[model samples]
Target: MPGMPKPIRLLSSQLVDQIAAGEVVERPASVAKELIENSLDAGARRIEIDLEQGGVKLLRIRDDGHGIPVEELALALARHATSKIGGLADLEAVASLGFRGEALPSIASVSRLTLTSRAAGAERAWQVRVDGEGRVGEPQPAAHPTGTTVEVRDLFFNVPARRKFLRTEKTELGHLEQVVQRMALVRPDVALRLTHAGRGLLDLPAAADPPGIERRLEALLGAAFLEHALRLDAAAVGLRLHGWLVRPAFSRSQADRQFFFVNGRAVRDRLVTHAVRQAFQDVLHQARHPAYLLYLELPAGLVDVNVHPAKHEVRFREGRQVHDFIFRTLQRRLAEGGLAGTEAEPGAPSPTIDQRPLVGGAPPPAGTPRQAAMPLRLGDERAGYRFSFAAQRPPAARADAAPPPVAEESTAEGGALPPLGLAIGQLSGIYVLAQAEDGLVIVDMHAAHERIGYERLKAAWAAGRVTSQPLLVPVVVAVSAAEVALVETHQALLQGLGLAVDPLGRDRVAVRAIPALLQGADAERLLRDLLADLAVHGDAGRIAAEIDRVLATLACHRAVRAHHRLGLEEMNALLRDMERTARADQCNHGRPTWVRLTQQDLDRLFSRGR
Candidate 1:
């Protein structure tokens, strides 16, 4: 019994390296990610890439950075041999992206690899080679500049099975280009040149300033991104978040435009995704995706960068804190600046306003559209905003809605104009038309009221925790086994959302209680939907979002419906509310609540500006 067979033995260096290659080199994209990261970490301001046959036959990367020294050329290919990290301390707070030093060796073990490098002020450049068997070649003098060149050939040649699993040429190139694109986005100051099969794919110059960076973004992400993007700069505690968030009105059908970097390294972390997704939850529709290029900076010690071999995933020491910070920061930006946040262009024609003289301060003649309207006035711009009663009330009352009448406030001469302008008349019984300082303001009555109502509902709900009612008879919903487990495991989180979910059987959950607001609602369907959201997004962070959806549903029902005729006072009242409501530009569904067309735009449409 004491003599157990020993299976432990030292694996050959080649075999051990091949095993590392298995995890580090999945395909051409994997190879590109590691190589580009190394170039960036070396302080390279410019990088050049060339690939052929989808990088299966050849992959070459050259960088203008401090390269490997002649003496260290051979050592560069050895596993775990790196000048990046010296000890456990350096490992704890890795500042460079290539501290692990596994990329070179792991790649060499799977492909024919060569590295030629010359550090700054070196007498001459040097080159080292490694074959598929992981055998290192002696260093030799090579003609080169103050930079590095790495060439990989015949990827996965040693393992025919792995080579066979690669996708088609176009598919692989797409993945490889995505890798380059992601890296290119992260380092705007770095000039990157990419070529595939001798054809130039991407040529981007280095940007040294913010405007230049914006130009680069426009080129890469497209002009739409710049037109719709809102610059975000916010810091709290020890974390700083700064970048561009596309307006919700410009959400994408797919998530291809979302690029997030943690301390300059591009990452796809769940905590970050969850936080951003949650922030845009209410504003964006279910099928739509928010587009953003967000960058976060914090002390390295608070984050673990070595969690994934590819470095695409990171572990934040304070996950919930980071999540909350990201959510609150982005949420605040969206609230402060509604859709189309930019102001009117400079050097435009001086505004021309029309005024209607009032006799006896009488109410505007019924059914007679007025030529004058009040422009948007400055007020408290925070989320908890409300309009002055004077902006809504008139000298006389309207049966449609009730507000105290005011005689002096009827004319723009009495006070400042409102930001949304004063409503002139309703169009097609749907849109409320208004005249602003420099342009025309068109408001969708239903969408405007829906957002205003939704905000109020949320404010009221936040004032007091959600009210829940116990179901007299528990409603059992049929669900998959996993859903049942979800309800059982997250019982506390569900309870926090005013849902008491208990597993009924192998594939069912009994909802014993639901939020009071959703009492008469379909409890079974809501529970099932909540379970589905949890499965896809994970955790209690999205539970509040579930509550928001229910609120939005209620708000939609109570909001003014299209085709509902309204008096001039009623229209003005809605406009006044929109000027102060949170996220007033868009409804709960992310559809724009209002739109503006400058006077010049109208002139152009009618060829009056020619």
Candidate 2:
């Protein structure tokens, strides 16, 4: 054969596997992933991982599962070869967590790799060594329990360029922990252990039941999740989805805990995330993401898993159908109160929808404040939104609360510093439409109440003059020891807010009295949520936020019920209160309490005189 070009010759199978390693094994965390998957596929019930310097010098995975035979060690290091599947047809219904089969060879090509395995009945264990360049040392006999231990040392030694891109050791280890967590979440039945430099990092026992599984998740994520979550199950188009999603009232700054699994494989698909947010539209604020764990069970033939080398992303045969299902199901679930929706009991008052005020309304009522014509933007990218003259008012230039605190507080100084205008009427029995100096103001009765309650609680607590009412029945709150610690730390703070809770046991607390504001409220449910927040944030400052949150809910419950035909006098008083209230122009949560525009807006819209 004619001599090939040097560059072309160098790009052989050996180099190809090395190149694949770039994507599959980006850092020590990547190596940890490949090794852990091997352990899981072996049917190991208990898996332990130990790392050092982000596994740059040492990465070890020990699992109790069927080990490799001594003779097959060399073939295991060959590129593109794996015991995971036999041929192309096997790819259709892949049940094993680890596929692709290139993980071992890729690592072996770029790092010093060692594998030790012992069959269940074998008396002696065997070890295999593969150095960079895919060279293998002899398989030597050794002693070990039935299982396998795979170690990769000097990761990226053969690829200096890749090593340079690696992050700090702490960062690399954090990634490793993330992989371990994702795996642990899906496989709750498996006992998972992780250590760094001989120090125990995480040790989670196997979960024997669903509750146990959820408890494990709570521990890993946060105990607050236990209460914030609601179970959702939906089946459509031969696809079944079952999981837990956070209530609209409960959210995080980021969407890190959103887990989606197809069949048994964890994957990230944009359609699902988008559908979730769409379902939660208008419920969550723009930057706040909810937490969810969703599992999808459908025919394997419908999905194409060969789209990416890492297999984290997948293509659906019926992508739109899946998207629609996710959207509708989540929307339905959220509508059921997990998000935001109104409900009334039989014989209870039904909400009266106000059409005129919500859409194009008569020009500003005569004798109203002089408002600037401020334009309002609405609508979304998918479903175009429109804004008509709905109660346009003058624009009073002002902002709501200073940049919100990372955590909520019952009392935000100067929160109610200024009033916007007068409350006119409610829209659809939910939004309180009020009039301001420059524009119309809308307030979420619930959010406004919450802000008022928060401020009240903070003042009382700061003054050490909290008013508590003894519950007709004392309440018992079940929480974890960690939460108990949080409560003890904030005992004085909570007491000052008129809540008296004493730790009765390791994972339980006794509630003696609650804040007078919550006299008729669901004390049990409220305390449970409080403990959940404490467990999640682990910060005393979060208590202040919780107080505000509770107050908001209370306000929603206490505020003039939607559908209540307001007397003109009451409406005028509401408007006057809003005008004198700080943040009157906006709701407590930053949503505009009202929006206004002048006659000029109509002129501009009609282009009568530019």
The deviation in Å at residue 261 for candidate 2 is 1.6
TM-score of each: 0.82, 0.58
Query: Per-residue CA lDDT of candidate 1, range 99-184, in tens?
Result: 78899999999999999999998999999899778778899999999999999999999989889899999999999998888887
- Ten contiguous residues with the weakest lDDT in model 1: 348-357
Error of 2 at 298 (Å): 1.4
Candidate that scores best on TM-score:
1
User: Which stretches of candidate 1 lie above 4 Å from their native place?
Assistant: 1-8, 339-417, 474-512, 520-543
- Candidate 1 Cα deviation (angstroms), residue 533: 8.9
After superposing candidate 2, which stretches have Cα over 4 Å from the reference?
Answer: 1-13, 338-610
lDDT of each: 0.78, 0.65
List model 2 lDDT by residue over 353-403, tens digit each.
111121121223332322221221111121221212223233341222111
